[model samples]
Target: MDQVTAAFDATPRRDFLPRAVRRRASYDGPLGIAAGQTNSQPRTVDDMLRLLDVRAGQRVLDVGAGSGWTTALLAHLVGPAGSVLGVELEPELVSFGSGNLARTDRPWASIRQAEPGVLGDADGAPYDRILVSAMADALPVALVDQLADDGVLVVPVDGTMLRVTNPGAVVTAHGRYRFVPLR
Candidate 1:
Protein backbone atom coordinates (compact mmCIF):
# COMPACT_ATOMS: atom_id res chain seq x y z
CA MET A 1 0.00 0.00 0.00
CA ASP A 2 1.07 3.54 -0.62
CA GLN A 3 1.90 5.88 2.24
CA VAL A 4 -1.58 7.41 2.19
CA THR A 5 -3.33 4.07 2.40
CA ALA A 6 -0.87 3.00 5.05
CA ALA A 7 -1.76 6.11 7.01
CA PHE A 8 -5.47 5.36 6.58
CA ASP A 9 -4.91 1.85 7.85
CA ALA A 10 -2.90 3.21 10.75
CA THR A 11 -5.63 5.67 11.66
CA PRO A 12 -8.69 3.59 10.60
CA ARG A 13 -11.17 6.10 9.22
CA ARG A 14 -13.94 4.13 10.94
CA ASP A 15 -12.63 5.09 14.34
CA PHE A 16 -13.15 8.76 13.65
CA LEU A 17 -16.73 8.35 12.39
CA PRO A 18 -19.77 8.84 14.58
CA ARG A 19 -22.06 5.87 15.21
CA ALA A 20 -24.64 7.15 12.74
CA VAL A 21 -22.01 7.55 10.03
CA ARG A 22 -20.02 4.35 10.56
CA ARG A 23 -22.03 2.33 8.04
CA ARG A 24 -20.78 4.56 5.26
CA ALA A 25 -17.17 4.25 6.30
CA SER A 26 -16.10 2.27 3.22
CA TYR A 27 -18.60 3.75 0.75
CA ASP A 28 -16.12 6.09 -0.95
CA GLY A 29 -19.02 8.53 -1.08
CA PRO A 30 -19.86 11.56 1.02
CA LEU A 31 -21.71 10.82 4.25
CA GLY A 32 -23.51 13.24 6.53
CA ILE A 33 -21.63 14.30 9.60
CA ALA A 34 -22.58 16.85 12.23
CA ALA A 35 -24.37 19.95 10.98
CA GLY A 36 -25.41 19.85 7.27
CA GLN A 37 -21.99 18.95 5.93
CA THR A 38 -20.71 15.60 4.69
CA ASN A 39 -17.44 13.83 5.29
CA SER A 40 -15.23 13.55 2.21
CA GLN A 41 -14.39 10.26 0.48
CA PRO A 42 -11.53 8.20 1.79
CA ARG A 43 -9.73 8.12 -1.58
CA THR A 44 -10.00 11.85 -2.05
CA VAL A 45 -8.95 12.46 1.51
CA ASP A 46 -5.97 10.20 0.89
CA ASP A 47 -5.03 12.05 -2.27
CA MET A 48 -5.14 15.40 -0.51
CA LEU A 49 -3.17 14.08 2.42
CA ARG A 50 -0.46 12.87 0.08
CA LEU A 51 -0.35 16.20 -1.69
CA LEU A 52 -0.05 17.99 1.64
CA ASP A 53 3.52 16.68 2.20
CA VAL A 54 3.16 17.15 5.92
CA ARG A 55 6.30 16.91 8.09
CA ALA A 56 6.99 16.58 11.78
CA GLY A 57 6.60 19.76 13.83
CA GLN A 58 4.48 21.51 11.19
CA ARG A 59 1.14 23.11 12.04
CA VAL A 60 -1.80 22.07 9.86
CA LEU A 61 -5.22 23.64 9.35
CA ASP A 62 -8.09 21.46 8.13
CA VAL A 63 -10.90 23.52 6.63
CA GLY A 64 -14.39 21.95 6.70
CA ALA A 65 -13.32 19.48 9.36
CA GLY A 66 -16.59 17.48 9.20
CA SER A 67 -16.06 14.33 11.34
CA GLY A 68 -12.42 15.25 11.93
CA TRP A 69 -10.95 12.25 10.12
CA THR A 70 -8.69 14.34 7.92
CA THR A 71 -7.60 16.39 10.89
CA ALA A 72 -6.78 13.28 12.83
CA LEU A 73 -4.73 11.89 9.97
CA LEU A 74 -2.79 15.12 9.67
CA ALA A 75 -2.16 15.18 13.37
CA HIS A 76 -0.69 11.73 13.09
CA LEU A 77 1.38 12.67 10.08
CA VAL A 78 2.84 15.68 11.81
CA GLY A 79 3.43 13.81 15.06
CA PRO A 80 3.25 15.18 18.61
CA ALA A 81 5.47 18.19 18.12
CA GLY A 82 3.17 19.40 15.34
CA SER A 83 -0.33 20.80 15.93
CA VAL A 84 -3.47 20.55 13.81
CA LEU A 85 -6.63 22.67 13.98
CA GLY A 86 -9.82 21.46 12.35
CA VAL A 87 -12.11 24.41 11.56
CA GLU A 88 -15.76 24.06 10.64
CA LEU A 89 -18.39 26.64 9.83
CA GLU A 90 -20.99 25.09 12.11
CA PRO A 91 -20.49 25.15 15.84
CA GLU A 92 -22.07 21.72 16.24
CA LEU A 93 -19.59 20.27 13.79
CA VAL A 94 -16.83 21.80 15.82
CA SER A 95 -18.15 19.96 18.87
CA PHE A 96 -18.57 16.73 16.94
CA GLY A 97 -15.08 17.01 15.46
CA SER A 98 -13.63 17.65 18.87
CA GLY A 99 -15.33 14.56 20.26
CA ASN A 100 -14.16 12.46 17.35
CA LEU A 101 -10.60 13.75 17.53
CA ALA A 102 -10.45 13.19 21.25
CA ARG A 103 -10.34 9.45 20.59
CA THR A 104 -7.08 9.73 18.67
CA ASP A 105 -3.80 9.24 20.55
CA ARG A 106 -2.49 12.54 19.25
CA PRO A 107 -2.94 15.27 21.82
CA TRP A 108 -1.98 18.03 19.38
CA ALA A 109 -5.20 17.90 17.39
CA SER A 110 -8.10 20.29 18.19
CA ILE A 111 -11.22 21.70 16.50
CA ARG A 112 -12.36 25.27 16.01
CA GLN A 113 -15.62 26.54 14.50
CA ALA A 114 -15.62 29.72 12.50
CA GLU A 115 -17.49 31.54 9.73
CA PRO A 116 -17.38 29.76 6.39
CA GLY A 117 -14.71 30.91 3.90
CA VAL A 118 -12.49 32.30 6.60
CA LEU A 119 -9.02 30.74 6.58
CA GLY A 120 -6.76 30.17 9.54
CA ASP A 121 -7.63 31.03 13.09
CA ALA A 122 -6.04 34.49 13.33
CA ASP A 123 -4.90 33.48 16.78
CA GLY A 124 -3.25 30.45 15.17
CA ALA A 125 -1.83 32.17 12.17
CA PRO A 126 1.03 30.88 10.00
CA TYR A 127 0.17 27.25 9.45
CA ASP A 128 2.81 25.10 7.75
CA ARG A 129 0.16 23.17 5.87
CA ILE A 130 -3.49 23.85 4.98
CA LEU A 131 -5.92 21.31 3.57
CA VAL A 132 -9.34 22.51 2.39
CA SER A 133 -11.71 19.52 2.61
CA ALA A 134 -14.61 20.93 0.63
CA MET A 135 -14.44 21.72 -3.09
CA ALA A 136 -13.80 25.30 -4.17
CA ASP A 137 -13.54 27.28 -7.39
CA ALA A 138 -10.16 28.64 -6.39
CA LEU A 139 -7.84 28.94 -3.45
CA PRO A 140 -9.28 31.49 -1.05
CA VAL A 141 -6.88 34.40 -0.74
CA ALA A 142 -7.32 34.53 2.99
CA LEU A 143 -6.15 30.94 3.28
CA VAL A 144 -3.17 31.56 1.05
CA ASP A 145 -2.35 34.59 3.16
CA GLN A 146 -2.41 32.52 6.31
CA LEU A 147 0.31 30.11 5.17
CA ALA A 148 3.74 30.27 6.77
CA ASP A 149 6.40 31.38 4.30
CA ASP A 150 7.43 27.75 3.84
CA GLY A 151 3.93 26.32 3.90
CA VAL A 152 1.88 24.35 1.38
CA LEU A 153 -1.82 24.67 0.48
CA VAL A 154 -3.66 21.78 -1.15
CA VAL A 155 -7.15 22.16 -2.65
CA PRO A 156 -9.24 21.10 -5.62
CA VAL A 157 -9.31 23.92 -8.12
CA ASP A 158 -10.95 24.11 -11.55
CA GLY A 159 -11.92 20.44 -11.57
CA THR A 160 -8.39 19.35 -10.73
CA MET A 161 -6.33 18.65 -7.63
CA LEU A 162 -3.83 21.44 -7.12
CA ARG A 163 -1.10 22.29 -4.66
CA VAL A 164 -0.09 25.87 -3.98
CA THR A 165 3.15 26.25 -2.17
CA ASN A 166 4.16 29.45 -0.47
CA PRO A 167 5.39 32.17 -2.90
CA GLY A 168 2.30 31.47 -5.08
CA ALA A 169 3.41 28.60 -7.33
CA VAL A 170 0.58 26.22 -8.32
CA VAL A 171 1.01 22.59 -9.38
CA THR A 172 -2.21 21.06 -10.74
CA ALA A 173 -2.95 17.49 -11.57
CA HIS A 174 -3.41 16.49 -15.19
CA GLY A 175 -6.60 14.69 -14.15
CA ARG A 176 -9.95 15.90 -12.82
CA TYR A 177 -11.78 14.94 -9.64
CA ARG A 178 -15.39 15.42 -8.51
CA PHE A 179 -16.16 16.62 -5.01
CA VAL A 180 -19.02 18.25 -3.13
CA PRO A 181 -19.01 21.94 -3.88
CA LEU A 182 -17.33 24.25 -1.41
CA ARG A 183 -19.82 26.19 0.69
Candidate 2:
Protein backbone atom coordinates (compact mmCIF):
# COMPACT_ATOMS: atom_id res chain seq x y z
CA MET A 1 0.00 0.00 0.00
CA ASP A 2 3.02 2.28 -0.01
CA GLN A 3 2.56 3.19 -3.65
CA VAL A 4 -1.12 3.84 -3.15
CA THR A 5 -0.33 6.03 -0.16
CA ALA A 6 2.21 8.00 -2.13
CA ALA A 7 -0.19 8.65 -4.98
CA PHE A 8 -2.98 9.62 -2.64
CA ASP A 9 -0.70 11.94 -0.73
CA ALA A 10 0.59 13.54 -3.92
CA THR A 11 -2.84 13.86 -5.49
CA PRO A 12 -6.13 12.84 -4.04
CA ARG A 13 -7.63 10.50 -6.58
CA ARG A 14 -11.07 11.23 -5.19
CA ASP A 15 -10.69 14.89 -6.08
CA PHE A 16 -10.21 14.20 -9.77
CA LEU A 17 -12.91 11.57 -9.84
CA PRO A 18 -16.55 12.34 -10.38
CA ARG A 19 -18.61 12.44 -7.21
CA ALA A 20 -20.24 9.19 -8.28
CA VAL A 21 -16.92 7.49 -8.79
CA ARG A 22 -15.28 8.78 -5.63
CA ARG A 23 -17.37 6.31 -3.73
CA ARG A 24 -15.95 3.40 -5.65
CA ALA A 25 -12.28 4.25 -6.11
CA SER A 26 -10.13 1.23 -5.41
CA TYR A 27 -7.32 -0.90 -6.77
CA ASP A 28 -9.53 -3.91 -7.23
CA GLY A 29 -12.07 -2.76 -9.81
CA PRO A 30 -12.45 -0.39 -12.77
CA LEU A 31 -14.20 2.93 -12.13
CA GLY A 32 -16.35 4.61 -14.74
CA ILE A 33 -15.80 8.17 -15.80
CA ALA A 34 -17.34 10.37 -18.46
CA ALA A 35 -17.81 9.32 -22.12
CA GLY A 36 -18.42 5.71 -21.25
CA GLN A 37 -14.79 5.21 -20.32
CA THR A 38 -13.29 4.15 -16.99
CA ASN A 39 -10.34 5.13 -14.88
CA SER A 40 -7.90 2.34 -14.19
CA GLN A 41 -7.84 1.34 -10.52
CA PRO A 42 -5.53 2.89 -7.93
CA ARG A 43 -2.92 0.16 -8.15
CA THR A 44 -2.90 0.39 -11.94
CA VAL A 45 -2.58 4.13 -11.76
CA ASP A 46 0.37 3.78 -9.39
CA ASP A 47 2.08 1.28 -11.61
CA MET A 48 1.66 3.37 -14.72
CA LEU A 49 2.85 6.51 -12.96
CA ARG A 50 5.91 4.66 -11.70
CA LEU A 51 6.67 3.49 -15.22
CA LEU A 52 6.38 7.04 -16.56
CA ASP A 53 8.88 8.29 -13.97
CA VAL A 54 7.28 11.70 -13.88
CA ARG A 55 9.09 14.38 -11.94
CA ALA A 56 8.49 17.87 -10.68
CA GLY A 57 8.87 20.76 -13.17
CA GLN A 58 8.15 18.56 -16.19
CA ARG A 59 5.43 19.31 -18.67
CA VAL A 60 3.17 16.33 -19.30
CA LEU A 61 0.60 15.43 -21.91
CA ASP A 62 -2.23 13.21 -20.74
CA VAL A 63 -3.77 11.58 -23.78
CA GLY A 64 -7.24 10.06 -23.56
CA ALA A 65 -7.85 11.71 -20.23
CA GLY A 66 -11.10 10.27 -18.90
CA SER A 67 -12.17 12.20 -15.80
CA GLY A 68 -8.78 13.86 -15.55
CA TRP A 69 -7.74 11.66 -12.63
CA THR A 70 -4.36 10.87 -14.11
CA THR A 71 -4.02 14.42 -15.37
CA ALA A 72 -4.56 15.74 -11.87
CA LEU A 73 -1.98 13.32 -10.57
CA LEU A 74 0.46 14.54 -13.19
CA ALA A 75 -0.28 18.09 -12.20
CA HIS A 76 0.64 17.28 -8.63
CA LEU A 77 3.71 15.31 -9.65
CA VAL A 78 4.97 18.16 -11.80
CA GLY A 79 4.07 20.84 -9.24
CA PRO A 80 3.48 24.53 -9.95
CA ALA A 81 6.45 25.01 -12.26
CA GLY A 82 5.15 22.39 -14.67
CA SER A 83 1.89 21.93 -16.57
CA VAL A 84 -0.37 19.09 -17.65
CA LEU A 85 -2.50 19.22 -20.80
CA GLY A 86 -5.26 16.66 -20.84
CA VAL A 87 -6.54 15.88 -24.31
CA GLU A 88 -9.67 13.83 -24.80
CA LEU A 89 -11.84 13.05 -27.79
CA GLU A 90 -15.28 13.93 -26.43
CA PRO A 91 -15.96 17.55 -25.74
CA GLU A 92 -18.50 16.93 -23.02
CA LEU A 93 -16.21 14.54 -21.29
CA VAL A 94 -13.38 17.02 -21.62
CA SER A 95 -15.59 19.67 -20.09
CA PHE A 96 -16.40 17.35 -17.24
CA GLY A 97 -12.77 16.62 -16.58
CA SER A 98 -11.89 20.27 -16.86
CA GLY A 99 -14.60 21.07 -14.38
CA ASN A 100 -13.18 18.51 -12.03
CA LEU A 101 -9.77 20.09 -12.38
CA ALA A 102 -11.17 23.58 -11.93
CA ARG A 103 -12.41 22.57 -8.51
CA THR A 104 -8.88 21.71 -7.46
CA ASP A 105 -6.41 24.09 -5.84
CA ARG A 106 -3.69 23.08 -8.25
CA PRO A 107 -2.88 25.76 -10.83
CA TRP A 108 -1.07 23.72 -13.50
CA ALA A 109 -3.93 21.54 -14.65
CA SER A 110 -5.87 22.05 -17.88
CA ILE A 111 -8.02 19.95 -20.21
CA ARG A 112 -9.11 20.02 -23.85
CA GLN A 113 -11.08 17.82 -26.19
CA ALA A 114 -9.35 17.14 -29.47
CA GLU A 115 -9.23 14.75 -32.37
CA PRO A 116 -8.52 11.30 -30.97
CA GLY A 117 -4.89 10.10 -30.71
CA VAL A 118 -3.45 13.62 -30.65
CA LEU A 119 -1.03 14.97 -28.02
CA GLY A 120 -0.09 18.28 -26.38
CA ASP A 121 -1.67 21.55 -27.38
CA ALA A 122 0.09 22.61 -30.60
CA ASP A 123 0.80 25.81 -28.69
CA GLY A 124 2.37 23.78 -25.85
CA ALA A 125 4.70 21.63 -27.88
CA PRO A 126 7.64 19.55 -26.66
CA TYR A 127 6.33 18.08 -23.47
CA ASP A 128 8.79 16.36 -21.13
CA ARG A 129 6.52 13.36 -20.71
CA ILE A 130 3.44 11.95 -22.43
CA LEU A 131 1.14 9.36 -20.87
CA VAL A 132 -1.58 7.85 -23.00
CA SER A 133 -4.25 6.51 -20.65
CA ALA A 134 -5.82 4.38 -23.30
CA MET A 135 -4.36 1.47 -25.22
CA ALA A 136 -3.87 1.32 -28.98
CA ASP A 137 -3.03 -1.37 -31.47
CA ALA A 138 0.08 0.58 -32.45
CA LEU A 139 2.11 3.51 -31.21
CA PRO A 140 0.89 6.85 -32.51
CA VAL A 141 3.88 8.32 -34.33
CA ALA A 142 2.50 11.79 -33.87
CA LEU A 143 2.88 11.54 -30.09
CA VAL A 144 6.48 10.40 -30.33
CA ASP A 145 7.34 13.36 -32.54
CA GLN A 146 5.64 15.67 -30.05
CA LEU A 147 8.03 14.69 -27.30
CA ALA A 148 10.97 16.93 -26.46
CA ASP A 149 14.32 15.51 -27.61
CA ASP A 150 14.90 13.97 -24.20
CA GLY A 151 11.25 13.45 -23.40
CA VAL A 152 9.52 10.17 -22.59
CA LEU A 153 6.32 8.73 -24.02
CA VAL A 154 4.56 5.83 -22.29
CA VAL A 155 1.90 4.08 -24.32
CA PRO A 156 0.05 0.79 -24.05
CA VAL A 157 0.39 -0.80 -27.47
CA ASP A 158 -1.56 -3.70 -28.98
CA GLY A 159 -3.85 -3.60 -25.92
CA THR A 160 -1.42 -5.79 -24.00
CA MET A 161 1.96 -4.16 -24.35
CA LEU A 162 3.47 -1.13 -22.63
CA ARG A 163 5.93 0.78 -24.78
CA VAL A 164 8.11 3.65 -23.66
CA THR A 165 9.63 5.72 -26.43
CA ASN A 166 12.35 8.30 -26.19
CA PRO A 167 15.00 9.75 -28.44
CA GLY A 168 16.98 6.90 -30.03
CA ALA A 169 15.14 4.44 -27.79
CA VAL A 170 12.03 2.29 -27.76
CA VAL A 171 11.07 -0.31 -25.18
CA THR A 172 8.08 -2.65 -24.99
CA ALA A 173 6.62 -5.10 -22.49
CA HIS A 174 3.62 -7.39 -22.34
CA GLY A 175 1.07 -6.78 -19.57
CA ARG A 176 -2.57 -6.93 -18.63
CA TYR A 177 -3.66 -3.33 -18.28
CA ARG A 178 -7.32 -2.45 -18.54
CA PHE A 179 -7.90 0.89 -20.21
CA VAL A 180 -10.37 2.27 -22.70
CA PRO A 181 -8.91 1.86 -26.18
CA LEU A 182 -7.47 5.03 -27.65
CA ARG A 183 -9.53 6.14 -30.61
TM-score of each candidate? Answer: 0.89, 0.88
Residue range with the least summed lDDT across 10 consecutive positions in model 2: 1-10
**Decoy 2 TM-score against native:** 0.88
Q: In model 1, which regions exceed 4 Å deviation?
A: 1-3
The 10-residue segment with the lowest total lDDT in model 1: 167-176
lDDT of 2 by residue, 95-176 (tens): 8888887877777888887875444466677888888888777777777778887888888887664756567657768477
Candidate 1 global TM-score: 0.89
1-183: candidate 1 lDDT, tens digit per residue? 765666688787777677877877889877777566777777778778888989888999998787888988898888889899888887887888888888887889988877765565767788899998777887677777888988898887668887888766555563577766667
RMSD, every candidate, angstroms: 2.0, 2.3
Best by TM-score: 1
